[model samples]
Target: MTGIDETFAGRKGQASATPGAANVPPAATGARPSETRGVHPDAVAAIMAATHGDPFAVLGPHEVGPGVWEVRAVLPEAKSATLLTGGKRIPFERRHPEGFFVARVETQGRPLYELAVEDWDGSERTRHDPYGFGPSLEQHDIDALREVGSNVTYRILGAQAKAVDGIQGFRFAVWAPNARRVSVVGDFNAWDGRRHPMRLWQNGGVWELFIPGLKAGAHYKFELRGPDGSLLPLKADPVAFAAQKPPETASVLQGTSTPAWHDEKWMATRGEKDPRHVPISIYEVHLGSWARVAEEGNRYLTYKELADRLIPYVKEMGFTHIEMLPITEFPFDGSWGYQPVSLFAPTSRFGTPDDFAAFVDAAHEAGIGIMLDWVPGHFPLDAHGLGQFDGTHLYEHADPRQGFHQDWGTYIYNFGRTEVSTFLAANARFWLEHYHLDGLRVDAVASMLYLDYSRRQGEWIPNRYGGNENLDAIEFLRKTNEATYTHAPGTLTVAEESTSWPGVSHPTYTGGLGFGFKWNMGWMHDTLNFVSKETIHRRYHHHDLTFGLLYAFSENFVLPLSHDEVVHGKGSLLGKMPGDRWQKFANLRAYFGFMWGHPGKKLLFMGGEFGQEKEWNHNQSLDWHLLDDAHHRGVKDLVRDLNHLYLNVPALHARDTEAAGFQWLVADDQDNSVIAWARKGREAGEVAVVVSNFTPVVREGYRIGVPEAGFYREAINSDAERYGGSNVGNMGGVRAEAVPSHGQSHSITLTIPPLATTIFVRED
Candidate 1:
């Protein structure tokens, strides 16, 4: 006697002998000597070792003889076991020293029963055998899992809490094609692998089990044995809907209850309007460090708190949308959600999934959209994650050159694999459909588009065409975009691609990548470089400001001053200016005006609006106290006015993606370091003139061409005294004269303020 038999005695008719065996005859005990004769030896051995691929075939109820029914169970912690069925209790005979129990009944058919067992410590309980339930997934689910573009995988797989045969419990499923055995282990079963082995669906390589007594909120993980019978680490579910707070790596079961959504008006009309033709000014945020409760040990605010506080702030600031960094479950805090491990689970550091949904709903109710910075690029190789899942390179590439990211020290997904690609494509649909998110700004797209990205020669692998392009990744991206657009109509999908890949924001039917918007990385880099120089030196770099227009309308663009520009020792946007304290503030205000007046959408990271003097720190709150200074406060006010003007004026947004929307009136004025441009709307007589003086000397009576002759009101002036600038400008408005200049029939002579950008709209 080794395990359960070591404490409890065995009967005479039982197969295994123990310390206290009752010497009763077969007739007296109503038992036969051949009760365990028909059981297979190999099946018993496999069940004892927890390596049985199909535990249901041998562990559940079965017929051992013509009229004899047998119920078998592996209760390793039990001292005694009894089978209760049809209002009768039959004591089980110990079949092995390792706690294998079997009970034989002379019934006509296999009987349904429950196991009433006493643990080694004298605690007694009864449980419905997990193996008694049949497969919970249908044939259609298997087909969908195997299909290439199916977006229903999240609904089919993972721990789904449902009732099967009227028994309320959870049905667990995971894809591990090469695993020798897989089991559902949790606190309910004492984390025992042999207690609940899953049934294997060979069609999709998915292992499923229906635990009859399980409930939601229970933590669990899959215990797997590789194909070679070697036990691997406990792996977290890739499709887990929720997970334990970081540092404790267990997947929490969130039942099938969906959060109540009350954003009917936002959802109903979202798809009717095109984003390119609307005013879209986004406020990028990193939720964790944006604000914290300093009194309570500097803890991150809950999602509800954010909804209560952050939403109102964004609405007041006149931003149309709030773009948050990745909220997916991850292990490291410093990685900032970029190296995510659980793609499906929203990080538990915030409240539950339902709490996050409420936050989005709150934003929508406030007339603001929510966008997530989605990362489908690379994943960290953390133990208990997707790395070496099933003891093989199942989700990632096997070769280091193709599968590994040397720069990030992470594993790259093998987009060539059908299952892997399908998994990622379905994940994109999951967030958009399940959470009612307004948009997804795909991150690190440049890394996905190139095979030799950040790699030197001879250190990388080429595509099948012997080129640097990743063909499979390109196809996967195309498929993902197509699926999202088809399923979640009206939702935006923006790409953070930095290279010159043609037509990145164009239609897929025209051989484009099919992103709704692409970040204007070239404009950000060039404009930042030019503005960082002294005003006297700006003449040589004037092309940097004018060059972006050559391809501005090539794709729909969003001018982003994202968090990447401020962190990693790169200094703050205000600190990047080369001048005195007053001049630095003026330059930032001027650049913001320039960015807002340009021919694209706008996005500004948090703290940039108020001109935070210090660099962004993910571990601490933003320097919000800087707003106490009048200079910083003025910048914030300027941003608010810029957003409102951009929203109210159609000429600034209506034709943003069309070349006809913009015309340069002073593109070659490098010597004066002054440039002017005219913006036009779709309709006639809707036009605005913009002028910028990069130097510190105000130009008196500077002439700017205009398409229409009328009263041009100064809609916004970065040099206004209210924005901490020298109070110099055209008093109220400028009247266009008949003087022809810069190929236009009308022109306006105005006083251009120093280190400022001013906009004048024609009053129709």
Candidate 2:
């Protein structure tokens, strides 16, 4: 056996002269030439300072001579260390006082050994050496990472649990090209940076390490030194699958276990249908405040609880889909998930990742589609987030004009960068694929399309073509849409873009940003303004209701009375009506009838359906108790009936995006405050006629044109007494006469209810 006495013979005199050797006590015996010749003292100094860029070269087993091999380790907590190989124990020499040990052995090939360590408190443990393994990533991973739209960042980075050569552990990796050094620090290593300095792949600027014996649920963070050799704040993993509940910012190790999906039937047929031609009535919800268990300290419901309570309620309300507010992990509750930190993690505020998956499964099983409000536009500048990641503006632009959002006080993603754009595009695909989500409503897309968005003249930078459009962001969006549709066939992407940039919902091959649908902000603004006016003065603003039809088919649109419209002193939808309590409810019911009759898909914020009296407060539950009121319950029933009608009637939804589906029958009746139109289905002679009276006066003998001479049955009347309105109607049916009116060969005369919208379907 070659003991420490023979290995340290020549190193005694030389230790006093080496750079960091004075701090290391001399070994017991003189060192042999084979044991001490290969290792350098300067490398030891760098390792002792925890600033080594290439720890793999100096710390792992290295061949010293023809048959001799030397091994080195930096075990900070160990009082003594030994290398166990080939059924023999070789004790290591104490090269430094900071627990740096070295051992030389005679091995035929490379050495495979386990470390036996004794701590200062007299406790002993046996563990696999972290440096014993080779690199966990390959050249293909680096090549894929640098390619535009490759979307391999998540698979390559973050703490991934796996087995390396029959030993179970985690392989931690991060992208920090500008970092001089990066270390994986966690509770396993006593939060010490010196314990696990990672090996950098220079080609991709990724640092990786295989830490044997780490289990799932272990908290970890990347400790990085900037290019200038300055230590940066420990940053949470950008691609973390799960993170610690906020106020504490470490990333948790989530194993490679996927939830067993039971949504195959939903997934199999979703891609076969076209979203534009289907009846889509969305109930927008902020899960945190949707409902709280007041008895349980008013806490937010878990994902499982929401699956049980929320899904049944939505199904009962007759909504086809539920579009949730952002549920990605975010730091500030007030941001309502707009400013996300971990793009891949479902917010821990609800439950684990698997629990969230179960909620989606429940939604699918109930025949309800689920969509997430995805926010990739901007991220908050929290210290532990992606801001200033890697000690530089690696994920964001260095220039404030291109990087900072003045209105939101957040950091805009550097979409121009290949890695950053790929990161975002992959995240978009991740949610759709991993969670089996039906759709993603991309938030704040207008902020991403234009460089000068909400900025003063000199506060923004122009594109390469000297235009205000953000070219890089535009390309990123197009590629992301392409990837999402290609990978997750049934899923769709909707843009909450408030701009008139043409063909936002068009295919990318036609020089348009490819989104499945675009939110019609103009229609929302115009129609809401028209309904909020007093009954007598509504005639002056009559065009507000009619003007939207001029460009209704410009893009596939979603007529949204979203959360944005009900918050920030904007008041509830009920509060926006200018009238007494009874009139307010009447006007809101009429507006809902009109909206359901209009030429687009639908989305209504949660409280708007029940006419919540107060404005939305993100801190508390929605005024669910308001349903106790007769008028509020009536409004809720109206919404449920409207949804059912929209779903069952082909004429109302079959050709929503086509101009041939709608025709104006009495559009220019501003003097009487009345408007009328007809909706057609794909098949011939299938039609539904809708008329609205803005004034509070019942108009008898209201004549409207029809396509064919038949009996038209009153399908829905907003002024029915059951809906809290004066009982006024055409006695259930109106027969068309052979008289020409408004260019149609047939006409029908009926009583138009006061402050109501009445819908008629051809019965014969």
Candidate 3:
């Protein structure tokens, strides 16, 4: 059986599983094996000197002579020590009294053993020796990690439960190449760094140590002595898989277990379909503030509770997916999870990584996808985080101009560094591979794409080519995207990009950034601005509603009324409308009608559907009670119908990103404050007509062109009484005549409501 070596590399003295040689070293001369104090002075002195750098070199076992062995231990907590295993209790010889024990015994081969100790407090305990095992990871794995560019760091680094020479221990590894000494410190070693110094991975910059007695759920942190041997702050593990809930700030050692996945069927079929042509309506949420247990101090719901409650609500609301705000482990709740300290650990606020996995599985089973808001562009400058790690700028650029994000008071990653790039790439893989998330909505992508983004001219540095682009960040994004898609084929990446930068959702092979979708921030800005104005002054801004069509097909897009719009003192979507209460609800209903009919996939932040009045507060639960009011319930009902309609009607979603699927019927109706368009599916006779009237005056017999001569049903009307409107619309349907109007051969005349939008689909 494999355990402590019982001997250290067969040093010339004695080999022992039993303590005390017949003769001991002389104390006056401090000789190897002369009769004096019953223990060798060299071994005793080495034990007293804790900074030997290699505990395995002198403290464990040694073969001093033929068929003879020596064993030693430096147990600072012990008052007495004994070698106990295989039914033999060999008492140790106490040499020099500072808890140094040495013994000698004759043995033919190495033996499995344990250390028994009596503490100064009169308590006794036994543990497997941590110093006797072989390397926890294979040499090949270490070599892969040293390459730095290879995407296998997650497999080697961090706290891994591994078996070395058949002995189980928690093998800890971290990247701190500039440190002179790195040690593992925890309650096991009385939080003393010198008690268990780690072995360096020789020029690779990684330090590792296997403490056999350690196991999952142990709290630990790394202590590193800087290059010049100056003391820096103790830092949490960058590759830690779980961390103590914040305000605690220590990484918890965890054992990796494969989650029981029920998403196999979802995975097998997602690759065959193109998301651009599918119905995608995402409901963005902040898990902490989404809901709470009011009866229990209004605390956040656990992942299990969210899985049970949130999943069914979204599915019933007809949403295809739920896009969460950043769930990565961040220190500050005020930052809304944007300032992450641990990329690998899921924020322990909700639950363990396993709980998050169950949540994803629940979503998949409910036929809804999950998208995480992944923040890789920058990190918080918390002391125990990646900032000044290893007493150097290991993960970020050394220069403030290049690395600091002035807007966020955070540090930008050094994407040009190999280890940094690999760490990010592997992290993305971990989420997809382990958690089974359907996609990532990459945050702050605009900042990553340009060097001058949000920076004054003097505050930014140009690339090597003397341009404004951030080439290193661009390369890093491409690597991460390629690796994520390669390793998890069905998964996707979306960019929250607000720039004219070209080819964002295009394939990387064609020199594009390789994203599946880009948020339509321009659409959101112009449309919201238009609807926020009074109807009397809205005619001049009619172009705002029609202008987005100019670039609607520019890239695969998701028109987002996201959290960014409602946070940071910006009023709620409902509060942004400038009118009386009735008019306010009408304006919101009409705009949502326009949005659903617009040519892009939909993404609405939490509280938008039910007309949340106050701005979103990250610390507070959503005003779900607002649904009790008719106006709020009306908006909610309208949104629910809009979602169901968008999914059922092929014409609305099948051509959301293609130019051929959309055509204008009344582009020059600004004088009447009206606009109409036809959305077409690939099949003949599949068409949807969208008309919006921005004026407060009802229009009777409003003639709009149709693609074919047939009966048209009012698919949806924001003015319907069920949706809190004035109840004005064509009874059930209208007929198309052959008279030419607005360039189409067929025309339809109908009573259109004031300040509302209506959709009509062909019935025959």
Candidate 4:
């Protein structure tokens, strides 16, 4: 379904108030009054119509004469209103029938007072005037927010519970530049837009109000009247730190919580270290489907519960990091947290924002880093969201071709606009600075890099130079990277770019996108295709095995076997093999062994380590019961060993992005479906030789050349019996002799396992 249709039932690209029209208060008496009085006619009209641009000008206390003050209050639900000072009561004149009441204080100005209002139904209540406070947005903040990107927009704009002048309440602010007026409406005022009209900063286009005595957890939305005086639907705050669960679109008032960050050591050293040459084995996970309580109606684990279970599980698996699919607040569970509605708020699916923060803390304490799959290319066009905000294409572009994403039915962010660009850049910094996430893996980067992505020739608009490159998005990405890397030192930004974009992982100052790493999509595609072919046919397609070496060092690449490979009808990684059960298990092990031994970091999606036979289903937990089988358990064990081996051995990880670190021993033994290579560290002796035989034929006395003459101990053999393999290969180790073979002077003549890959480390 289109995102527009998700919130609005009618009126495309226009704000019509039927569902929200009830929020607008009925008009008061139309008699024009003099402006000298505090309760001016314009203020009354605006309050009655709920379109008064600035309520603070007239509603709050104003010194009408020396030592005498005129106090005005608009309680639309009240029948009579009075001002309450300590031990004294001052009555208010009902100026308009729409609950516009006024009172004059003669003693030492307006004095601290509260409003006691009697409703038409004989209900009386007393509360402090919400409009009595002043606007908190300064001119400097507005200029900085509009000019250069600022990271504190969330702190300034959302519903925040704070003590204002010693009065406790929630402060609400939003940016609706073109709106005629805006108001803070919630259950506190019966969703009446006229009850608490906001103070509009004319130049900055920001509306704000502080309601005293209000607490957090109250649901609220900004009720904006369009520039044309047309009432718009109540919108959820874009910078909201918390939100009500989906299907109920309301931003929640958030309370302050001091983060108990115990990861100072992790943060201190993480920035100084270079990840390119280090072993980073990431386990990509979809939190909702990772596990569930089957007996509890398949409910998902809370953030704390996930910390209890997932933290130890990943640490035990020896993975360096856990990459979670976007946990940002999304309206639909099926979007997998991609089409986010609230970027600042962690999804309420698991728990509160603090709950997610706690989860990160727990992971860090366990020595595991966490990465988020951040989606910034586009957002859902839900009416309450940024789409057509203030009855215009404020957040997105005006034209459909430029503004819309056809494939996803979402709204593309107009990165060229300064406010929009700054808002997004700030969001990128929010997660890293607030929740202490280690890195971001930007999703759908190809779509952002190109104008014609997933579109026909006429459906897309080219750049000023008539090129397909999206210059604005490119600039925005650079800005985001600069902000993230600068603000959150030691954090990483990875790109899931599918195209052959140049210098994607290079430094921004050196003319690049500035991501720390890029996903090796070509390697994933080619290798998965090669492994899917029958053993006899694999000989003809040997280039797939050797092709990745051609550009392995092009960027700091991460060899990903991710969720995209196992979802839909693609089947599991184990299920993708073209072999019987035993052969399938062997092929998977061999493929993983090759992957771990390759010249790059590694990523394995959830359940792929255990040889999950079925395709990934986001609605349910993975087939964990399969672990009871020896083959499944064997696959898990192999992954664990691969991670440990990769971390401990410098040859496997160090200099992974340097061409000098790799040397091919045999690249043209395709007839036997065999390929061998050596990985070297910065110096000699830090080397590992890998040999893979794709067929079920054990090649005995296979003379493989090595650089050094020493005892080559078998580090990992995919065909070992412990890994549920046939155990037909090297027993413990092989000794290399001074002989020339495959261009190397030292040669190791040994038994090669069938349909397996093996790693042999030369002893020191």
Tens digit of per-residue lDDT, candidate 3, span 1-764 = 01222334353321221122211122312333321223345535633543333345445655556656667777777889888745888888876666667766667765567889998888989877765554454545656653433557877899888776667778888888787667788867887775676766554567777788677888888887776667678889898888989778888887566788888898788777788778999999999999888889989999999999999999989999999998888889999989988888888999988888889999999999999999989999898899989888999999999889999999999988877888887888888877888899999999998999898879999999999999988888887888888877877799999999999988899999888889989999999999988888888898898899999998999999999999888989999998899999999999999999999999999999999999999888999998889999999999999999999998999989999999999988888889899999879998999998888889998888888888989999998999999999999889999989988999999898988999998878
Off by over 4 Å in 4: 1-38, 108-110, 118-126, 147-149
Model 3 whole-model lDDT (C-alpha atoms): 0.82
Runs of candidate 1 exceeding 4 Å displacement: 1-37
Supply every candidate's count of residue pairs whose N, Cα or C atoms clash at under 3 angstroms.
Answer: 0, 6, 16, 1
TM-score against truth, every candidate: 0.94, 0.94, 0.92, 0.93
What C-alpha lDDT do the candidate models reach, one value each?
0.86, 0.86, 0.82, 0.84
lDDT of 1 by residue, 109-168 (tens): 557788899988998899888866666776567667655557767887889888887888
Compared with the true structure, model 4 gives a TM-score of: 0.93
Scored by Cα lDDT, where does model 1 land? 0.86
Each candidate: RMSD: 6.6, 5.4, 5.2, 6.6
Candidate 1 collision pairs: none
In model 3, the runs with Cα more than 4 Å from the true position are: 1-52, 64-68, 85-87, 93-101, 109-111, 146-151
The 10 consecutive residues of candidate 3 with the worst lDDT sum are: 16-25
Of the two candidates 1 and 4, the one with more favorable TM-score, higher being better, is 1
